[model samples]
Target: MRGLLLKLLFSLMLCLFILGTVLTAFVWYVFNYSDDRPRSSSHPIRKNPEADPSGVCKECRENTIDKMVEIHSHTWKKQEANFKKFRSQLTSRCHGATKAIVTQVNTPLESKIVYDGEKRKPLVVTPKLFSTFLKEQPFKNVTWETCAVVGNGGILLNSSCGEEIDSAHFVFRCNLPPLDKGYEKDVGNNTDLVTANPSILLEKFEGLMEHRRPFVESLSSYRDSMLLLPAFSYGHNTPVSLRALYTLQDFNSPVQPIFLNPEYLQSLARFWRAQGLRAMRLSTGLIVASLALELCTNVHIYGFWPFAQHPHDRRPLTNHYYDNRQSKKTVHAMPAEFAHLLRLHGQGVLRVHLGQCASGPR
Candidate 1:
């Protein structure tokens, strides 16, 4: 009877030991390898985008927006921005609008236009070239209540933000993005100003040296919007920018081509550098966003995401909304630039739109 009781006790002890070992292994796996960790009240668990492939999970969206209230905010709330203070800072630091565009008044008949990118090279203004300059700055006497600076990131793929974007008093776009072929519903038709990189002329239009008619037709989509060109930014850009102006004028298209002041661009670069942004050059998005903050009372930014995967869905995204082409990683420090915008969004200086827009207009 004693041997029998001892055997039963030993068996029970072995079973308990086995169960405890199994439980310890599971706990170790979960804490060390698996995605389970103790959470502090200050740092909540971040939602994994991989788990929500459909991106329609409303709970994740709400939690993302509610918890961080920065980059992943699915909802946009208009905060009472200290417009005067912010505008004052921009003006004092960069003088953004003072010489925003190169005009006949700013560039003299024989003035040397220093290249912003290649500071050593400068373009001398000739009489014929001087004629293309706008008589004065654009929107000088007008006031814009709100402005939209639209980027071309694929985050805007299905975002129905077109109506809300068009409702802004002024709309600015980067890199002369296509606004047609079923894209107008998402990107909007209004463009008060659009920047045209010199590369576009070289790549898309073949330097405008031949087949100029195609270039003329492309301008039809912008419909009288000012073509902001960095004509003096590089030495090679001058000829092509001049050609674009001549093409528009020859065709008698309402679209106007204007040069961006290199000096203003340099100052703008310094302004951002002062804020600790160290990139080869500021991406066109950041430059335009800074300009919008100074030019308008309220600024709203769209499609500024720089990640390869969707913030909420983890699906692959094209570099741009219109194409799957990737950007040159070495050219721009995009992620770092986006971080600056995120800070601005947090401070209520600007509104960065993420996720899809509401069904109805704002």
Candidate 2:
């Protein structure tokens, strides 16, 4: 009888436990069922886009206005002093650069990739197995007087700055941008040196893995300009860049293919970092402009603006003059860089040409 009583109590306990578990699970399901079930909307909700950090923001606009007012109100003597200071800062390291650039293949051959922030290794050029036609920097003998470093920014569209751009003794273009179509009037036909981003190799030429004829044919507009590639910037870019050289040679293209000295890039990065730009890497246009400051007696930059809207008016413009490729917020602090460039322009250290160049010889 006592055993039967104990078993009855045990059965009652088990029933109670099962009931409690069921109740707890039901409560949990009631709370979380909506999370699992999808909510289908009849009408889609449109969200407003966030502001671009790469472009001029509200604060930048206000600051630019303040600087303009300050410049307009200031005396010529003060501006001259500022310009002198700016010139000193830019040319402090890069004037008549020799060791900074790789003049010989042996300089970097068998050398580890020490340039830039990344620590990469074992990158070498074996002449016995790997042959390169590119021997040295192409324009080592030339000294440019008036140099123009053109940005591919959409601000150059309809600006008619081509004549002004061509007037420069030397011109630097970024990313092997198209010079044909209707862009010649704004971006100019002259090209001294154009830097091709490694990304361009992958995207446009399929990393030059096959059918390099398209790549060679694309250089028709550039015609005898030097093709500068950041081949050693990263170890992966080396093969594609070397292939580009071979392609040019096989077709005997007039465009002289040259690779950028990683050391030159590293020094350029350090220069910008000292100027308060904490970026992963400096933009190609900015690097070209920095080189221009050292190489050219007078520098005139066109299409360097990095704002979505016109600084004077609030009208939006295309991100690039060539294609409507939407730009994302980048590691490069473009607005701050532009502001620094504007300040330099204010002091007459360089000329920043924006929108609609006046016709005739610039």
Best by lDDT: 1
The residue-by-residue lDDT of candidate 1 on 1-362, one tens digit each, is: 99999999999999999999999999988788754555677986666564666675656545543443435464545556555666687888776666889888878899988899897877788898888888888756556888999999998888788887888989999998988888877888899899999898999999999899998888788898889999888888888998999898899989988888899899988888888888998888988899998888788889998876677666777889999888787788887798788777777778778768764333
For each candidate, what TM-score against the reference? 0.78, 0.76
Model 1 vs. true fold: TM: 0.78
Off by over 4 Å in 2: 1-96, 99-101, 105-109, 115-117, 128-134, 139-141, 359-362
Full-model lDDT, candidate 1: 0.82
What are the RMSDs of all candidates, in order?
16.1, 7.9
